[model samples]
Target chain A: MDVLRITFLRIVYSALLLAAVVVLNFVMIHLAPGDVADTIAQSMGGADAEILAQIRADYGLDQPFIVQLGQYIWKVLHFDLGSSYYYNRPVTELILERLPATLLLVITAQTLALVIGVVTGVFSARRPNGFLSHLVTIVAFFGHAAPVFWTGILLLIAFSLQIHWFPVGGMRDVTVTGGFWAHSFDVARHMVLPVFTLSTTFLALYSRLCRASMMETLGSDYVRTAKAKGLPMRSVVYKHALKNALSPVITLAGLQFSAVISGAVLVETVFSWPGLGTLAFQVIVARDTPTILGILFFSALIVIAGNLLTDLVQRLVDPRVRTGQ
Target chain B: MSFLLKVENLRIELRMRAGVAPVIDDLSFELAHGESISFVGESGCGKSMTALAIMGLLPEGIGRVASGKIWFDGEDLVAASPARLRHIRGNKIGMIFQEPMTSLNPVYSVGEQIAEVLREHQGLSRKAAWAEAIELLDAVRIPNPETRATAYPFEMSGGQRQRVMIAIALACKPKILIADEPTTALDVTVQAQIFDLLRDLRRQTGTSLIMITHDMGAVAEMAERMIVMYAGRKAEEGPVDKVIAHARHPYTQGLISCVPHLVAHLTEERQDLNEVPGIVPGLAEFGQGRCLFASRCARATERCLTTRPEEIAFSDVHRSACWHAEGM
Candidate 1:
C-alpha cells in the first residue's frame, strides 16, 4: 500500500518536472536568434512578405507563446504528440517505431556487461594480488578512461575493416524480409559493433566498482565467518561475498542506464541504427518541436523508470532495504 | 589419555621484506576429548593467528606456519589435502568467531546459513537441513525459532546473532569447537548466557572446546585448563583454578592481579593495571633472548636476559616458564 503511494507520488512529481522542462525547452528555442519563418524564407528564394505571413499562420507559428504552450500541453496530456513536420508522421509513431531497436541494443549490452563484469570483479577481488587481478585492473583502467567513440572506431577498424566479421554501420540489410525472428536477428547482427562499443566503458566501470565493493566485503566479518565455517572458497566468493557486492553495482547500473541512453545518441547517429537516439539527433537538428519534446519526455521516462526498477530489484535482493523504504 | 587434538611445536612466521625470525615459536598444546582449554594473552600476542592457522584459513600472502604438526584424531591437519581439510573443518572442528554481527552473512536467512553447514557436513537434503536448523535454533533458546530462522542476520540483535552462530557451529555436532572470543562483544548477562550454553553443550555431547580469549573472567568461568600466552609463547599452563590462585609466571601474576575481584580488600592495593609498563614487542626484529617477558618483568635479572627459562613443573598438572618459578 505504501509502495503504491510512493510510486504514485513519484509519477506525479516526474510529470510536473517533465512538463516544466518541456516549457523551458520551448522558451529557449523561441529566444534563439533564428526562427522557422526565417528558415522557410531563406529556403523559398526570397518569398513575398504576404506569402511568408500565410505560411506562418498555416503552421500555427503566428500564435501567442502562451496559446502555443497550452495547446501542446493539452495534446500531450491527451496522448497526442502531434505530427512531425520533417518526418511527415505522428511523433509518437516515429518514436515507437525506433524504440524496439534501441531497447534491444541497450538491454542486451547492459545485461552482457553486468554478467561478465560482475563475475570478473568477484574473481579479481578474491585473488587481489594475483596476476589475473592485476591484469583486470589495468584493462579496466583503460576501458574506463578511453572515449566510447574512439573505442567504437577501433572496434570497427579491427572487426569490420580488417577481419570482415560484421557490418560497418546501420540496423539491418535492406533485403531482409518477413516476421519477428528475421527482423530481430537482422537488428542484432547490425547491433554488434555499437553495443560492443557502448558496453566497453560500462563493463570496465562495473567491474572496477564490483571489484572494489567485493574486496571491501571480503574483509568484512561475515566473510571470515563463512571461511571459519569451512565453506569452500568458491561458495564463499560467489554466495557470500558477491551478493553484498552487487548492491553497489545495482545502484551504479541504475544510474548508468540514463548515461547509456544519452551516450547511445552519438553512437546511434554515427551507426544509423534508426533508434530514438538517431531520431532525437535528427529532430533536434531540424528543430521539429514536437519530435524533440517527445524524445525529451521519453528519455526522462526511461531514466525515471530505470531507477524505479532498480529500487524494486534491490528490495528483492535485500529485505532490509525493503523495510527501510 | 586419549587426546582428540594435539598441536606440537607450531611456529608461525611473518614473511618480512627483510630477514626476520618467526613470530610464533615452538607453541605446543593438546586437547583431550570433552576438555575445554583457553589460550589467554594480550592483543597482538598471536592468539587469533594460532586459531586461523589451525583452521587453515590464514590471510593471503603474509603469514605461514613455518613448521608444525597439528594432529586431529590421528590425522595430520598441517599436511592434510585441501579437500580433506575442508571435510574436517566445520564437520569435526566447528569454530565460532568474536563479532557475531559481522560474522554472519547478512544476505542469507539465519536458518539458511545454519542449513548450509548441515548440508555441507551431514549431506542432508535442504528440507532436512532446514528442519535441523529450526531444532538447532530452538536448542540455542532463541525465541520464535521458526520466525527467527527466516530473519536475516542484520535483523537480529548482536547476542541473537551470536546465538545463531553457535547454533550453526553446533548444527553438525562436531567433535571439537574452537570459539575465539565468542562472547567478547556481548554484555555481562549475554556473556553468561553464552557460557552457560557452551557448558550445557559440552555436558550433553562431550564436545571438546578450544576457547581463545584474553578475559580472565571468561577463562575462570568456562575453561577447565588454561594456557597463558605472552609474546606468542606459552608463559604458563595449568588447571584454571590452580593457576589463577597461585600463578608462578610473573606475567600470569600480573594478569590475575588485573582481574577485578569482588573482594574489595583483595583489590584495594591494585597498582599494576597500567604498571605492566612496556607494550608487547612487535613481531619485526623480536628477540630470541632469555625471556620474551623479561623486558616487562619486574623480577628480571642477568640470568633472565641471558638464558631462556624452560617449562618447569609445579605439579603433574601445573607448569610455568620462569627462571624464578620455584621462588615465585
Candidate 2:
C-alpha cells in the first residue's frame, strides 16, 4: 500500500515537472530572436518573403505566443511532438532512435560508478587509517576536481593512441555490422573510455558522499550497540553500518542519474557516441526547435522518473519513511 | 561453585593525545553463576569501558587492555583469538547497551534483528529463528509480539525498543548478560518497568548479569553486590545494602550522600545538595606511581599524593582503596 502511494506520488510529480519543462521550452523558443521560419530560411541560404510567410503559416508560427503554447501542449498530450524540420522525421522518432545509445552509456557508467564507489567508500571507512584509505581519498579528490572532457581526452590519448589498445573514437569499428550483439559489444567497447572518464568524477563524488554517510552511520548509537552485542566485525561493518549508510547514497544516486544524463552532452560529443548528446548538439547548431524541445521534454521526464524510483526504493528499504510523513 | 565470568586486575589503557594511562585500573570482580553485580560510577569513570572490554568490543584507536585477565567459563577472553572470540561473543556472553532508541538497527524490523543473532549464534533456521524471536519478544513482555515483531526500531517507543534489545540479548540464552546503562535514557516510569522486566527475566532464566551505570538508585534496586569506581579505580566494593548504608571510601560516601533522601526532611539547612567538588582527573595527569584521586580527596595527606593506596579490606567481602578509609 505504501509502495503504491509512493509510485502514485512520483507519477504526479513527474507530470507536474514535465508540464513545467514544456512551459519553459515554449517560453525559451518564443522569446528567441528569430522564429523557426527565419531559422529555416537562414539555413537554406535565405528564402524569399513569400516562402517565409508560407512556411510560417504551414507551421502555425503566425499564431500568438499563448495560442501556440496551448496548441503545442494539447498536441503533446495526444503524443504528437510534430516533425523535425531538418531531419524530416517525427520528433518522437528522432528522440527514440538516439535515446538507446544515451541510456546504454549513462546507465552502464552510473552503475559502474555506484558499485565501485560504494565498495571503495565502505572499505575506506572501515579501515580509516589504512594505506588503501589514504590512496582512495587522494584519487577521489583528483577525480572529483578534474574536468570530464580533460579526463576523456587523456584517456583517449592513453588507451586509444599511446597504447593503441581501444578504438580512437565512435561507438564501434566500421567493419562491425550493427547486429544486436555486434552493436552492443561495439558500444560497450567504445563506452569504456567515455564512460570511464565520466564515471571518474561520479566515482569521486559518490565515494565522498558514501564516506560521509558511512561515518555518520558508524557514529550512530545503534552501530555501537551492535558492536556491544558482540557481532563479528564483518557483520557489524557491512550489515549493520553499510546498509544504513547507503540510504542517503541511494537518494543521491537517483538525483545524480539525471545530472549524469544531462552532463553526458559534453562527454558524448568528445567520444562521438551518437547518443542524445550528439543529437542535441546538432539540433542546437541547426537551431531545430522541435528536436531540441523534444529532447528537453524527454530528459525532464527521465529526471522525474529517476527521482520517483528513488522514493520507491527508500520506502521499501526504510519502513520509518513510509510510515512517517 | 562455578563462576560464569571473572575479571582479575583488568587494566584498560587509553592512548589519548597526552599519553597512555589506565581507564580501568586494576579493576577486579567476578559474577558467580546466576549472580547480579552492578558497577556504579559517575560518567567517564570507566564503568562502560570495563563492560566493553569484557565483551571485547572496544572502539578503534581509543583503548586497549594494558594488562588483564577476562575469564569467562574457564576461557581467557582477553587472550582469545578473533575466531574464538566470535564464538564466545553473542553466543555465550550477550550485551545490551544504553540508549534503546539507537541500540536496534533502524532499517530492519525488530524481529529480524533479534532473529539475526539467533541464526548467527545458534544456527537456527530462518523460520525457527523468527518464531523464537517473537517468543523472546513475548517473554520480554512486549505487547502484540506477532505484530510488533514486524515493526522497525523507529516505530517502537523507547521502552519497547529496550525490551526488544533485551529480547535480542537473550535470544541465544547466553550464560552472562552485560547491560551498560540500559535504562539511563528512559523516563522514570519506563525505567521502573524495564527494571522490573530485567528482574523478572533474571528470576526466570537464572542468567548472570553485570549492570553498569552511574545511577546508585538502580544499583540499590537491582544489584546483589556493588562496586563503586572513582578515577577509573575501584573505590569501594561490598554487598549493595552495606555499600549504601556504610560507604567506607570517601568518594562512595560522597556519591551516596548526593542522592536525595526523603528521610531528610526538606529544610532551609538542607537546601544545598551534596556534590563532589571536582571533576574526574585526567588519566595522564595521574601517573602509575600515585593515587589517581588524591587531588580531589578531601582527606588527602602528604602520603596520599606520593603513594597509591592498595585495597584495604574491612571484611573478606568489603574493600576500599584509600589511606583514609580506616578513619572514615
Candidate 3:
C-alpha cells in the first residue's frame, strides 16, 4: 500500500513538474532574441505587410502571449504540438521520425561509455598505482577537457581522411543498397566517430566518479568485514564494494542521459548524422518554435524517466534504501 | 598435540609517512582447542591489528606481518601462500568485527551474507547453504529466522546485526573465532545480551576464541586468559582471575582500577573518571629502546627510560613485562 501510494505521488509530482517545465520552456524560448514573424517572412520570400499579417495569422503568431501559451498547453494535453514553420508538418510527427535515430545514437553511446568507464574504474581502483590506472586517469582528464565537436572533427580527419578506416559523415552510404543486416552494419560503421565524440566526456566523468566511489567503498567497514570473513579478494571487491560504489555512478548516469541528447547537437553537426540532434540544429536555425518546444518537452520527459529509473535501480541494489533506512 | 593456534614473536609493521614502524612488536601467545583468550588494550594498542594479522586480513601494501610465525592447524600462516590462506580464512578461522552498524554489507540480506561464507568455504549448493544460514540465524537466537533471513542489515537492530555477524562468523564452525570488540558499538543492555549469546554459542560449538577488546569487564566476563597489551607489546598476561586479583604490571593495575565495581563501592557519590594518566604512544615511539609505558608508569627510573622491559615470569602461566615486576 505504501509503495503504491509513494509511486502514485511520485508520478503526480512528475506530472506537475513537467507541466511547469512546459510553461517555463515556452516562456524561456519566447524570451530568447528571435522573431518567428521575421523567420516566416524570410522563408516565404520577403512577404509584404499584408502577407506578413496573413503569415502571423497562419502560424497563430499574432495572438497575445498569454492566449498563445494557454492554447499551446491545451494542444499539449491533446498530444498536438502544432506544426513546424519550415517543415510544414505536425511537430510530433517530425520529432518521432528523428526519435529512433537519436535514441539509437544516445543509447549506444551511453551503454558503450558506461561499460568501458565502469570497468576501467573498477580495475583502476583495484590497483591504484598500476599502469592501467595511470593511463585511464590521463585519458579521462584529456577526454573531459576536450570539446565534443573538436573530438568529432579530429576523429573524422584521422579515421576518415588519414587512415580511410571509417565513413566521413552521415549514417550509412546512400549508394550501399543492401539487406537489413548489411545496411545496419554500414550504419554502425559510420556511427563510430559520432558516438565516440559524444561519449568521451560522459565516459571520463563516470570513470572518475566510479573510481572515487569505489575507493571510498573499498575502505568502508563492510568491505573490511568481507575481507576478514576470509572471502577471496575478488569476491570481496566485486560482491561487497562494487554495488555500494555504483549508486553515485547510477545517479551521474541519470543526470547525463538528457545532457547527452543536448550535447549531441554539437557532435551530430560535425558528423552530419540524420538524428534529432541535426534536426534540432536546423530547427533552431530556422526559428521553428513548435519543433524546438517539442524537442524540449521530449527531452524533459526522458530526463524524468531516467531519474525515476535510477531511483528504482538504486533501491533494488541498496537494501538500506529499499528498507527506507 | 600442538596448540590449536600459536603466535611466536609475532611482529606487525605498517608503512607510514615517516617509514616502516612496528605496530605489534614481539607478541606471543598460544590457544588450546576450545580455549578463550582476550587481548585487552586501549585504542591504537594493536589489539585489532594482531587479530587481522592472525587472520591474514591485514591491509595490503600498508600493514604486514613483519616477522614471526602464526602456527594454526600445522600450518605457518605468516608464510602461507595466498591460495592456502584463502582456504583457511573463512573455512577454518572465522572473524567478527567491532561496529555492528557498519560490519554487515548493506546491499545483502543477512541470510545471503551468511550463506556466502558457507557456500564459499564449504562448497554447499545455494539451496543447502541458504537453509544452513537460516539455521545459523536461529542458532544465534534471532526471532523468526525464516522471516528475518530475508531482511537486510538496515532492517535489524544493532544487537540483531551483531547476532547476524556472529551467525556469519560461526556459519562454517571454524576451529577458531576472533571477535574484535564485537559488542563495543552496541548499547549496554545489548552488549550484555551479545556477550551472553557469545558465551552460549562458544559453549555449544567448542570453537577456540580470541577476543580483542579494550573493555576489562568484557574480558573478565568472556575470556579464560587475558593479555594486557600496551603500546603494541604485551604488558602482562595470565589466567583472568589471577591477573585481576594481582595485576603485576602498573598499566593493568590502572585499567582494572578505572572500572568501577558497584558491589564494592556502593556509596552514592559522584566519582571522578579514573582514567590512566597519559595515553598510548604512537608508532614513532614503538622502537625507542625504552619501555613505551615508562612515561606513564609511576615507578619509572633511569633504567626504565634507557632500556625496554622483557617478559619475566612470576608463575608458570603468569608473566609481566616490567623491570619492577618482581617487586609488584
Candidate 4:
C-alpha cells in the first residue's frame, strides 16, 4: 500500500514535471533567433515581405507569444504537437515514427552498459590492487576522458573503415531480403558500433562507481559478519555485498538517463541512424520549433519514466525504501 | 585436549606503512567446555584483535597470526586451509562484533540474515531455514517474531539489532562463541539484558564464550575467568572474582578501580574518580625489549623500563606479569 501511494505520488510529480518541461521548452525555443517562418522563407530562396508575412500567418507565428503558448499547451493536452513546417507532417507522427528506433538503441545500450559495468566492477573490487583491477581502472579512466562522438568516430574508423567488420552507418542493410533472424542479425551487426560508442562513457562511470561502492560495502561490518557466519566467499561477496553496492549505481543510471538521451542525438546523427536523435538534429538545424518542442517533451517523459522505474527497483531491492522512511 | 579452544604463545602482527608490529604479543589462554572468559582492556589494547585472530577474520593484508597456534577441538587453526577455516568459522565457532548497527546488512531482513547461516552451514532448504530463523529470533527474545522476521536492520533498535547479531552468531550452536564487545554500543539497561540473554543462551546451549570487553563490570558479570591485557600482552589473569578483589598488576588494579562501585558510591562521600593515565602505545612502540606498559604504570621501576616482566604464577589459574606482583 505504501509503495502504491509513493508510485502514485511519483506519477503526479511526473505530470507536473512534464507540464513545466513543455512550457520551458516552448519558451526557450521561442527565445532562439530563428523560428519556422524564417527557415521556411530562407528555404524558399529569400521570400518577399508579403510572402514571409503569409508564411508567419499560415503557421500561427503571427499570433502573440502568450496566445501561441496557450494554443500550444492546449494542443499538447489534446495529444497534438502541431504540424512540422519542414516535414509537412504532424509532429507527433514524426516523433512516433522515430521513437521506437531511439528507444531500442538507448535501452539496449543502457542494459549492456549496466551489465558489463557491474560485472567488471565486481571483478575489480574483488582484488582492488591486482593487475586486472588496475587495467580496469586505466580503461575506465580513458573511457571517461573520451567524448561519446569522438569515441564513435574512432570506432567507426577502426571497425567500419579499416576492417569492414560492420556497417558504417544506418541501423540495417537496406537490401536485406531474409526472414526475421537474418534481418535481426543485420540490425545487430549495424548496432555494434553505435551502441558500443553510446555505452562507453556511461559504462566507464558505472563501473568506477560500482567498484568504489562494492569496495566500501565489502569492508562494511555486515560483510565481515556475513563472512564470520561461515558463508562461502561467493555468498559473502555477491549475496551480501553486491545488492548494497548496486543501489548507488542504479540511482546514477536513472539520473543519467537524460544525458544518455542527449548523447543518442549525437551518436544517431553521426551514424545517420533513423531515430529521434537524427530527427532532433535535423529539426534543430531547420529551426522546427514545434518538432523541437515535441522531441524535448518526449525526452523529458522518457527520463521521468526512467527515474520512476529506478525508484520502483530501489524499493524492491531495499526494504528501507518500501516502508517510505 | 580436553579444552574446547586453546591459544598457545599467540603472536599477531599488523603490517603498517612504517613496519610490522606485534599487536598480540605471545598471549596464551584456554577455554574449557561451556566456560566463559573475558579479555578486559582499553581500546587499541588488542582485545578485539585477539578475537578477530581466533575467528580468522583479521583485516586482510594487514593483521595476521605471526606465530603460535589456535587449537580448536584438536585442530591447529593457524595451519588450516582457507576453506577449512571458513567451515570452522560460524559452524564450529561464531563471533559477534562491537557495533551491532553496522554489523548487520541493512538491506536484508534480520530473519533472512539469520536464515542465511542455517542454509550455509546446515544446508537446510530455504523454507526450513526461514522457519528456523523465526525460532532463533524468538529465542533471542525479539518481540513479534512473526512480523519482525521481515523487518530490515534499519527498522530495529540498536539493542534489538545486537540481539539479532547474537541470534546469527549462535544460530548454528557452535562449540565456541566469540563476542567482541557485543553490548558496548547498547544502553546500560539494554546491556544488562543482552548479557543476561547471552548467559542464559550459553547455559542452555553449553557453548564456550570468549567475551572481549573493556568494562570491568561486564567482565565480573559475564566471565568466570578474566585476563586484563595491556599493550597487547596479558597483564594479569585469574578467576574474575579473585582478580577483581585482589588485582596484582598495577594496570589490572587501575582497570578495576576505574569503575565506580555502586555500593561504595552510595556509602561514602564523593571524591575524585580514579583513572588510568596515558594511552595505549602506538604500533611503533609495541614488542620492544622492555615492558610495553612501563611508561603508563605508576609502579614502574628502573628495571621495569629495561626488562619485560614474565608471568608470575600465583596459583593453577591466577598469574600476573608485573615486577611488583610479589609485593602486591
Total clashing pairs for each candidate: 1, 0, 0, 0
**Could you tell me the lDDT of residue A235 within candidate 3?**
90
Best by DockQ: 4
lDDT of 3 by residue, A198-305 (tens): 999999999988988999999999998887677888899899999999989988898888889888878888999988889999999988899999998988887787
Candidate DockQ values, in order, are 0.75, 0.68, 0.77, 0.88
In TM-score terms, candidate 4 sits at 0.98
Which wins on lDDT, candidate 1 or candidate 3? 3
Q: What local distance difference test score does each model get?
A: 0.86, 0.86, 0.90, 0.91
TM-score of 1: 0.95
Query: A147 in model 4: Cα distance from truth in Å?
Result: 1.6
- The i-RMS of every model, in angstroms, reads 1.1, 1.6, 1.1, 0.7
Instruction: Give candidates' CA RMSD values in order.
Output: 2.3, 2.0, 1.9, 1.4
**Top model by lDDT, which number?**
4
Misplaced by over 4 Å in model 4 are B263-267
Return the lDDT, model 4, position A82.
90
What C-alpha lDDT, on a 0 to 100 scale, does residue A14 get in candidate 3? 86
- Candidate 3 residue lDDT tens string, B1-328: 5799989999899999999889999999999999999999899999999988988888889999889999998889999998788888777898988998998898888999999998888899999999999999999999999999999888889999999999988888989999999888989999999999999999999999999998889999999999999988999999999999999999999999899756445576756658799988878889678899988989999999998998999889999999998898
TM-score, each model? 0.95, 0.96, 0.96, 0.98
lDDT of 1 by residue, B1-328 (tens): 8789899999988777776557678889899988999999899888898888888887767888889899989988889888888887888888999999789887899999999988988889999999999999999999999888999987888899999999878888899889999988999899999999989988998999989998999999899999998887889999999999899999998888777545468646755443366888877645386698988999999998898789999999999989999998
